[model samples]
Target: MLIDLSSNENPYAPSCKVAEAAIQGLEGMNRYVEPEELHMLRKALGEYCGVGTERILPGPGTGYLLERVLCGLAVGRELVVLNPAFLSCLDLAARLCKRIVRLQLKPPSFEVDWTLPASGPALVILESPNNPTGQCLISREALKSLLKNEDCLVLIDEAGYEYAGKTFMDLIPDHPNLALCRTLDKAFGLAGLRVSWLVCGDAFMKALHMENVCLCRPALRAALAALEEQRAVLEEVKGVIEERERLKAALSQLGLEVFPSEANYLLVRSPRPDLGLLLRKRGILIADLSGQWFSGYFRISIGRPEEHQALATAVEDILRTEEGFMD
Candidate 1:
């Protein structure tokens, strides 16, 4: 099916209530949007986040939220991030009125360095359960240490938190300098809607020009529906998580070095690069992480049960037949 694990998303749709609510919301299509729906979304989201609704800032997605965050912050200097980072961080930082520092992650762990710029204001960002290789976390102690050394803003992207089983949202209300951002696309299955939000301190939120509903009428409806019945959405998420664990084990059994992941993807290293290319010829698509290092590696997404089975069977067959990480 040409599964697109390249982007972290649940193939499932939002709750059944989401379809119903979307249909119901369409009935009021001719009229201007009531700020009330957005207010309701923020309320439900706040409850979900375990924070005040006023603390949550909703947007199109992480892209929009990050853009606004960089634009809104007048932190007199630049942005420093872990290189091989989610590319957008560097892309957005480029447009900002600041210097950009790209630090490569320390090998094996891929953790960022704590020695940040000690000058004026800085925006230091990191991702937990980060993209591409899906390298899980940087430890709570590391997070605390990073925050302690830099007086600047620390943004943590929690896009994959649902699969990772952790979040800093609960910490945002208490930690004035921390901002925790999340997107509905991964867990909620609302990728088409591009709905996302972040919980920051009241001071950080109040400074920006806030709007009740920033997305279009269609996306707002989807966001509300998804939030209203998050339990069902989470059920699908659990399935993805379970499948990921199974896939990880299968890869390990084959003697391939599979980088441990808390998210719904696996980074498997082969003795040679040809197996990755071979999988692509067989119509299987996964990222080639080989170029990043001198060694051979590829990342595969954990799809639905059948999709995962196909991947497992393919790997097993490859080993049983044309083994040797063939070209």
Candidate 2:
């Protein structure tokens, strides 16, 4: 096994029920599908997300949902984003040709500018439980500050929400300017299905141009089955959590600075960036995130036990090599 840890995904195979469900849905698949076919998904997600059906919507994945959220609100002005945020969010801002105001996340904690400027018709984007750094998510208090301003539209993409449960979805009704995007790729293990969703006030969904959102139904079907099929996904979730705790304990023993990780990955820095790259040459697939805000650093996903052990071994080998190099 190559042990693909590059994309943070649930390595466990999909439920047997999921395959049957997709096949059943396939009988009518040749026919044109209804947009309201999204209802079951919305209902299940609402139950999981604690948001109402009117407040939620689906997409091919979180990326498509995020694109629509930005397209609907993007006013051709500035879009404020955190630097070294997820790469796709950066690409979307560029595609929209929206002038970006990239801000470096300040230390003590990597946080965003909650009091973002009201200077232009700006759409603010950020990832909570943020991707590479594995830092703490922005709080509801921070969200309140942005929503209170009323001039900007705040979009929080919690792609790793499975690992970090904290979110601003409950406040959606209070802030029409607030839009939240979520995904099943991480939590539900339907990445192959490419499932994702969006939750906003009814007005936003009504105003949204939803043509592209319809194409994700095949994956959405698997996603829905995952939700309704009796806690099938939860077992894998529990496994990942257990492995995460185990990995944390092992990495801590090595004395590397493992930053607080709310997601499936750990943020680890070295005395020099070379160490991250050196481990990579050994056929290990951990993330090496050096010189991009988190220079001299890398991230490794919380994988299955066997994979975790192999990575830990590679890391130990690297450390022993480094000690020899120094001596």
Candidate 3:
């Protein structure tokens, strides 16, 4: 079997309730999803997020909701994003915003300055535990202070929130300009369901014209079930966390520059840039990030212990066989 560690998908299967609910949802496939059913989802999402139903808006996924928010609300505003942010975020900003300001992340540390220069209405997207790099943009306290400025709208993409355990959701109560986007696709192992929610404050929610957009019946049911059994989801996350530590230690022992990550994946800089191709030849797939900001670096999602061990062995073999391969 091929070991695929490119995408940061949960290495474990979903909760049992998700499958049962999905099966139940299939029986109602003949009808279009009802509005009341979606409202129910909103309620569940609100309860889970510790926000009100009005503050929560569910859509196909975070990408869809993000596009909608930018298209509808960010027309006249400028877009400020960190370098090496999500590709989708970049595409949306370019298509929708009039002006784009990219803040270059500091090298080695790969951290961005949270403070913004004097600017007009702008939509700032912050990806915590950023993809590929796996570094968080800012801390909770810095996020709160950034929200207080009221000069721009802050969209915090907390897709990796479960791994980092740092959030600015509580600051939403006081900051009307702040909106947080979360998804079940990451930690909850529900990527195929396309279930995500955008949480906004009262004033921000009032400004936008959110529709009755909802996920499919099966996805909604499964999302609700997943939320109900969230404890089990956390348990699975705990296993991933443990595996991540083990994998990091193992990779570091191999003398590779493994970057610090608070997410499900690790960013590793190999002495051999051809390591990705070598691993792929052995039926192991990883994220080759050479074209991206991290040259000579690849991203590997923390998989099961066996998968990690296999990767370690493959790396060792490739380095041993190849000439001039530095540690």
Candidate 4:
């Protein structure tokens, strides 16, 4: 069987309670999710996030919720984003926003300067522990400075918050212009269920209507079950982090430059761009970041130990063959 490690997903299956909850939800497939059930999910999420239920706005997925936020807040405003952000978010911004100011994050560290234009209305979108690079781009002080500007609105995607062990949700109470998009898809192993929510400040709450934010029955059940099993989620995140370090070390030993990551994947650079192709030939699929943003760089999601071993072995074989061919 082919080993797929391209998507940053939880390698382990979700807790037994989550599965049973989903199965139970299937019994009422015909009816839409009740308001009380949705409220329960939001209440559970609020408790998980340390915010009030009034601040939570549930949605089908992060991407969808992001689109809504952009459409509602981005028109006629200057859109500021990182160079290598979530691709879908970039694409959506490109289409919706008239003016986009992209802040490029250079390599080795992939750090952002956190400098915005002195004045004017702008919507700044940031992904903490940014995708592909897997590094947290902004600090609390820097974010606070931006929040001080009344005309500036900030939207942050914290999809990898569970792995990164950091968050800006606490700032929401004081900053009306700040909003956060979070999801159960990443750490909670609910990607297939498409469960996501927005922790909105007063401004966002006023702009976007909450009545339209509804989730399917199974998704609602699954997310609620997953939240209840936070202990299991913590254990899973610990395992992924350990595996990530091991995989990073293995790749570095093979002479590939692996960047430090806070998420469940590693950003690696190879001498040749065909590194993805070489591994694909061995029935191992990893994300080839060459054409998307950079060349000779790839993202490998943390997976089972055996799957990682197979990837390392394939890379070694490829390198060995290349050395022989050069001779």
Displacement of the residue 97 alpha carbon in candidate 1, Å: 4.0
Q: What is the C-alpha lDDT of each candidate?
A: 0.72, 0.71, 0.82, 0.86
Model 3 over residues 73-94: C-alpha lDDT tens digits?
A: 7777888877655646567777
Q: How many angstroms is residue 102 displaced in model 2 relative to the true structure, after the best TM-score fit?
A: 1.5
Which residue ranges in model 2 land beyond 4 Å of their true spot?
Answer: 95-98, 106-108, 210-212, 230-232, 322-327
Decreasing TM-score order of the candidates: 4, 3, 2, 1
TM-score of 4: 0.95
Candidate 3, residue 301: Cα displacement in angstroms equals: 0.8
Residue-level lDDT of model 1, residues 173-253, one tens digit each, is 656677888888778888877888888855467656666447666777777778777777677778887888887887788
RMSD of 3: 2.0
Between candidates 3 and 4, the TM-score winner? 4
TM per candidate comes to 0.87, 0.89, 0.93, 0.95
Over 45-78, each residue of candidate 2 has an lDDT whose tens digit, in order, gives: 7787888877777777777776776667665757
Off by over 4 Å in 1: 27-32, 133-136, 290-295, 317-327
Cα-based lDDT at residue 202, candidate 3: 58
- The window of 10 residues in a row where model 2 has the poorest summed lDDT is 209-218
Of the pair 1 and 2, which is ahead by TM-score? 2
The candidate that achieves the highest lDDT relative to the unseen native structure: 4
The CA-based lDDT of model 1 is what?
Answer: 0.72
Taking the candidates one at a time, how many backbone clashes does each contain? 0, 1, 0, 0
